[model samples]
Target chain A: MTTPSNKLPARAIIREVGLRDGLQSIATILSTAHKHTWIRAAYAAGQREIEVGSFVPARLLPQLADTAELVAYARTFPDLFVSVLVPNLRGAEDAIAANADLMIVPLSASHAHSLANLRKTPEDVVAEVARIRAARDAAGSRILIEGGVGTAFGCTLQGQVEKREVLRLMQALLDAGADRVSMADTVGYADPAMVRDLFEDALRIAGDRFWCGHFHDTRGLGLANVYAALEVGVTRFDACLAGIGGCPHAPGASGNVATEDLAYMLGSMGIQTGIDVQQLLALRAQAAQWLAGETLHGSLWQAGLPKTFTAAAAVAA
Target chain B: MTTPSNKLPARAIIREVGLRDGLQSIATILSTAHKHTWIRAAYAAGQREIEVGSFVPARLLPQLADTAELVAYARTFPDLFVSVLVPNLRGAEDAIAANADLMIVPLSASHAHSLANLRKTPEDVVAEVARIRAARDAAGSRILIEGGVGTAFGCTLQGQVEKREVLRLMQALLDAGADRVSMADTVGYADPAMVRDLFEDALRIAGDRFWCGHFHDTRGLGLANVYAALEVGVTRFDACLAGIGGCPHAPGASGNVATEDLAYMLGSMGIQTGIDVQQLLALRAQAAQWLAGETLHGSLWQAGLPKTFTAAAAVAA
Candidate 1:
């Protein structure tokens, strides 16, 4: 294994995923108006990329029932890179219809997790990716397709997911015509060492096509794992506002890394993310009010930004 | 800058500083009996180094008034490395009298913080260390002296503490007869990149004499900062159980990194801490009950160890 480079990227992207990932796992069903406000506030806080919601059936996930509306609302922002989660070709079709910039297809690398969570084998998901690509191409749409491999580290049900297996699925997704690929520690099983080891290889394999790193803060290693991936030149990450999400299968697990906290970390390191953390914290306060009764996570909300924290723009200047 | 070494040390130390740092700032004043239980539980959970309490006047800090009694109690465990915090020569005398393994003399790198917190300038603290060393030598005590520079990253009261000033203070402490030196981000201002840069320089200057890294999780970068230090080959860190400390001056800042969480991070990285994180969690549960109504911090308590986590001993084996 090579030593981790201390050099961080000059800029990075923190794709806000709270609308889909954070809202889906919670009990509250946020209204389309609330989601529209959330998207507006997030954009105001300088978030360029946002996964607004997922296009699953309303019966299965009523919390995300307004995915189409939210996508249309987010698309109104001229420079916003709007995305949505697509479970299959049908969801991808809806995303395209809503004119989303991208649609993410999640595949679980853990065989048991794939069956339990997605109701399909890993290979079956790859085939579905191929079908979705064909459909997108046939529609002559400009929407990008990102195959995000979850359980890339391990799974609660499967205990350990082999690194080789994760890499193989990522390659298969690319071969199946995925425009981009990303990895997710869906169950929060990833440590910095594991992230460094796997993400290094992923970068070698996919290079610039390795789109993002998604990490859950369940065991509190999310930011550290992001730091590890950052060391290996993975610049984009997925985070939830106030860290609101959890795997239903992993009891008591927390959400992804907090968007405000991640922004603070990157800014403090002189890595530009074009985010205003104070503005993000204000949005988080609004989110807490909307998602009352839910356990909100993150430290920056309490402590505020440090006296030494420089804004990303200031750092760049 | 050099690349960060991915090769973590085979073994590292997590020195528990809860009894001293945690109790001093909180309203809850744990009884001597509770402290005894805490020390016993921590030792049972495989923590060897512990700072039982500080040697300040009881009227000033009634919480840590039982420092001498606690030191005597902790000495019963022949293998335990017991330490205490001392403010000046008088406290060092008390530590030497108590036959403590070591005494940490804290020197603030920020002049404003130094005057406000300790009522002594940085140079004054260095001179005090010299007097303490003389006293220790005169008493022929085997107790070691560690000069810890706090606010080494930056200070809330003084904004930014210069790197040259911090390095100069560290060197001054050593020249004043300190047996070892360490750095602390007293107000939780440190980021991982700052940690890597400063700690790499510290390691170069002090080598093995650089005893520890003390970080506060006030802004959520504590564990990530620890990971950066680990990459730079520093193997010792100071943590509070359940993350039960905060700065009196910085109102919203949280405590040091949580002991159980830090243990979990190290074990996950295949570093042998000799700590059973499950046992540490149980102790944390007890600590929570003992200090009820006080806000505690950390993530591992909510989500237990991951399915993929191997015990440090197993990893070493």
Candidate 2:
């Protein structure tokens, strides 16, 4: 956790979203039993936080239908911050019952993306969050609520998402009683300069309430954009283990920045994340075996650690 | 070229090194005729600087055997800054005879790498630079002599190259009569933090005399490393057109950052590179077709530009 004083965040957290984001787009369907193994292995690999799956109906997304079960399983780990993606209040209720550490409700900033993907306007999603918050309070749930603003940079359905609009939605979500807000480059339209400019303004608006920076490696700027976000003090990121989550909108587009690659970059910069990169790579290999023929992406798996890096330091317990 | 204020360099240059760095590594034997076409198309695609070939012995590197001829062909373009790599005094003589715009002599900073790769110690290479400079002066050649320090970050054979050692070599090159100097992450053992910290000190020492930043994309930190150098106002970078180069020491390691992706990043950041990314992509396709079995690394060609990006701006005439 030895982040240079005030120059960069002392510690950063990489939340694994492979089960939710990675599986949602790919054709792979790991058994629920395998999902539990992933959770346990990830926790043992020094990953304290993981988005096991999304609380969506089996009919909608068969891949993450067992999210509640996965959340319950992940909860057994002492320090693991178990998280689930809940589309609406019904899913949030399930999350609360599972006693998850956090539930992320996603809202698209682009109206066109919102309508096309979520079948609702941006404001509608915001309003749904306010309702979800009320329900959580009524149920006396201690679970944290994170309002994730998707397509914060731009959208495939709608180009040029206005910065003011993204900021407005972010402020509205925080005012609606959410525990924290995060920004996602859902369609991978972000560049480093764009990330720095937007995240600067985002931190100014949300301050400590800004939870995470989620980036896709669609155009290969994923790690570069993450670096830019780090420049402005972002200490949390959402990534997949093998960078397997492709954007369904942009065919052949890549997925989230690979967790192994992200972890290597963070650890190399002397930023502590508590997750062992070596363990992450092993998990990636295990995940790769479970879902054969899937297009897994990442650079470190091929190149391994840099010669200057001490393998022991990145080795997970 | 509209450069930003002193905070960010308004104009940036993507010096094409695909021929020298890219072709030298791959097994593809592009004919002298194909090399001419590449140089012409690259120039027509708004590339103002190009490293045509290396002035090495024909038996050692048959691919770049036609270095002098390629330099002559590239020099036909009005605005093109034709350059070549000179391995020793003999190579320097060939570069001077070809009337190149610039000649780069590479020196490996890691002692083991220096002896293995170049058959010379760091000091030996520095002394050679002085001899090469004397020859260039005696030959009355205006061709700029650039002493390129490779493995400036770390090396595959010898790890943990000290920062002080890299700086000393760079200073020695300048004192030995080299016209300008550049630093290269030859093994891709660099992170953005390392790039920023080292490049900041390097810039402080060399100022604008620092000719270029050359990075390998081996560990996927190439563009991120480029961004870090850009933060310190580095305006020149060396890149392979399709990322066709791979380090020989590290098996499966990637080459210099791809020209097309680097161009896209710079253009999107509002840093002018005078490169049309679409045109670069077309050239990459042409190059790819020629080198069928080779693995070309880059992201933009696969995902394409985001809908928000104006592709027309990236299309060269």
Candidate 3:
């Protein structure tokens, strides 16, 4: 019942997924000016890591077609760690060419989802990671390679993914030459207990090589699951501002956990996530207007700040 | 981490505050049939505890004027623990006469809030609890008394509430013959760390006499705070369905954590909260139509259940 006197110094990293995850699902396409403004504002708000864009085909996701320009703009911020999602080796090459800090190659753990969405099996995607890694080494690039296992918990197309299979794929990715690996509850099926168990086991096998936890608040367990992951020592998390992404297949899958809400949760727990909640909420307000018809999700923006929060002091600085 | 093999027995109780807290805040007044249906559905959904109504003057809270009739109806359910809010001695009489399982008398720790809203100091309120206790004894009533310390975290009129004062008031209520006491984030200013520290202190003073944790997701930390309190062993919680209440004085203060979302969180964590989340969502659907113009808050309703939920077995049952 006692407060931990020297609460462990929270080194939590909140990766801004607004540009990629937030934009892709929403119908509205922000002009390049608004996109750059959002990136700059997020950086100014003390966000050190941001998922600026995805290297998907422009025709499939027209909202994020300006990603290349956005990635180039993000690189100008010295302190910011810019990352992007790459669907294949081609996307990885573009990322390396752009000198992105990190490139995530997503491989859906569910075979059905992998086939339906990516048109590749999980192993095929793992092989691509190897190819991407070899290409990076040949090109003498220092950009980090992340093998992100999406739908690691369950998939809408094929339900109930075995934990053993998920672990095997995670290890297989590392064996196939991925520099780092992360797990995602792409469909928000993970509970806190499941998160703690899977994450602990993943860390035991991968050690420090296991990098981030991506959760969708589609069922409102996102922050709770994050807390469980934190207990097991996972620090970095991927979150979309205003919780902006939804699964196209899953009828009503809402966005990922809202970035500002996550920041607030972490900051209030004495966790040192380097993002200003107030600024994030302000960013949400501007983004909301730009996304008028689309549904936005978050609690902090509507409730405002608690009186105890000294966020105004942080924002003023 | 290993799913705790023997799941934590269903220890938590979600006191349905939708009727009293939800309806009172919104402009809509549901028909008595809908209210009875809500109560019946909630009980059928395994909700053993509910705050059916607030015993306030009809002029003040017209929406809850049928509280007496509702309580009379709720009494028919043998296992259902129906409770009501009693703002003063007059409200307490009505509550005691109705033979409620429990009666909660709210005492605001903030002096400004107490005077502005209740027109009584916190000490005076504690004296009232003593009087109510005497009245119950005189009337040979078996109803339990709960002194709800509202605005315990902070207040809009009076900002930083001292932990010492809150603890003292909590102790005072117990000394004044209140059977149990609960802490509330009336202004939604409490963070998880604060929640842990305060609940720990309160538990130390009251022992098991400290009963429930009530939190407003005002700044999005309600569930986080609830988790912190759980870490310290507080089990029962107060949540409005769809997160439906707010402070009239505080411009954007929202309700407590959405009941359905909280149920999803605890149930997902493998903690048996005895709430049927899907049924809760169904109730939310009806409640939403009843509250078309008002704002509704929750994440799980929009996003259907996660694909991996085997709890569908229990929820379906």
Candidate 4:
């Protein structure tokens, strides 16, 4: 048997997506001021990559209306990788104008969810990526474009998404001028075995062009699925602090894997994520207050860290 | 990268331990009749293995006082593998007399936990396993003996259990006449990476003699750790239905990984678990009714099965 010990990546990036993915789905409209504080606190806690907010029309998603402001503020810190989600060229243009580090254009592999979420077919979204790339170049912006395949696993609406279609779309997105691409278990439908099977093949196809993995802990296998990707060498992950996001369609279903739990899991596994879990827990407490009534998820916050966690001490030593 | 797809076991067994582990940690004293219903329902749900209860003194653990009765009742189901926890020789004698399918003698890897939980050192537990083996032989009982190493990853009271010590105790348990041996993440401290590292080594030493894996979902990586063990081909697992048990010390810490969720994860990955998830969900509802006001864990109950889940239909087909 091949031991994963030797093959696992040394360091992984846990990109905080709570401000965007976490807030957008929940009912709470966190004040822009609270968003700023959350960002600053997360950065202070050693987070380098954060998807600040989505660059959507305020009328459509008022929760993330302050994306441009968040991105501009997050840029004050040197070496911070600020990301924003852009549905079409308008949002992508806003991201580029704001000098955001990266813009993720999510294309759902499930045609039904693609049309419902993006108002475009998967191929149509791919075409939009080409347009967004051209627009970025014309604007002389160095903003990276990532084509993230949402519902890469089965979908709540479409049920089973064919792997062949998912892979074919990934290649198309790359051909359409996306600088990077990633897979998302958008509704938390992925299991580790499925993750290993699909991601191993995706890695062979994309190599370094594969940006990260995004998993929703909806079915409670988010960490397990992430472990499968790690086994195949995908290091960067997208998560939300306190696991704040939940599926609007499926009530009680969780959103992204909780950042604190993911960080703890990765740290204990000896993978450097550069995020201090205690500080993340502090941020989680702040978030819980800001979005008081919304049901929050994440196990680490409840249990705290194990006594064997010496990564914090070792860093000082 | 060696893809984990081909390496994963095609089937797995989830041993329901809610009656033993789940009940012991909670304040709720489910009626013996209710436990019998749970056992019958769990058997109907496709769980072949069940840990009926512990053989410790009734005063110490009143919740499991009806263990022998439950074991005898569970044995009525043909093909059901009834197991019980035996803390010492007297408990083993009761198990042998009751004709239990198996009796697990737990040894804590952490010295502090060993003393606190079992009131014996790791070596003393090993000796007891030898005595239990001899007693079973002399009684001409066909019941199997399994030595389980708890806190194999780390302990709450004492942290950073040495891998060398864990392996040493497992070897000692085997040498002391255990028919089989298993490892447990007793405090939910194990990450999937640690599981793969340790379990791969353990599988090398024990092969098929490694009986089962028991994981707590306290920090939400239980399923992930299970996935890691599956990669190493450890099939049998110990879980509590609805995650009934919480660490008594930890106010809200979860108990064993919920059996339903684990089965759903395995079934989703095309692993044949022989259990029907719908049947398990029905059992979960009954459990929720039986233990009202108690915190129940497991994601599937909230969201129900994904529409893509075809486990039931496949069996029908």
Best by TM-score: 1
TM-score of chain A of each: 0.97, 0.95, 0.94, 0.96
Model 4 C-alpha RMSD vs. true structure (Å) is 2.0
lDDT of 1 by residue, A141-223 (tens): 99999999999999988889999999999999999999999999999989998998999889889878899999999888889
Candidate ranking (TM-score, best to worst): 1, 4, 2, 3
Listed for each candidate, the true contacts retained, as a fraction, are: 0.72, 0.57, 0.56, 0.71
For model 4, the superposed segments whose C-alpha errors exceed 4 Å read A1-6, A247-253, A312-317, B1-6, B246-253, B312-317
**What is the interface RMSD, in angstroms, for predicted model 3?**
5.2
lDDT of each residue in B76-141, candidate 3, tens digit only: 997899999998889999998998999999888888888887889999999999999999899999
The global C-alpha lDDT for each of the candidates, from Candidate 1 onward, is 0.91, 0.86, 0.83, 0.88
Q: Where's the lowest-lDDT run of ten residues in candidate 1 chain B?
A: B1-10
Between which residue pairs do clashes occur in model 3? none
In model 2, the runs with Cα more than 4 Å from the true position are: A1-6, A250-252, A311-317, B1-6, B250-252, B311-317
Better by DockQ, candidate 4 or 3: 4
In candidate 3, stretches whose alpha carbon ends up further than 4 angstroms from where it belongs are A1-8, A312-317, B1-9, B312-317
Better of 1 and 2 by lDDT: 1
Docking class of 4: medium
For model 1, fnat equals 0.72
Predicted structure with the largest lDDT when compared to the true one: 1
Between candidates 2 and 4, the one scoring higher on DockQ is 4
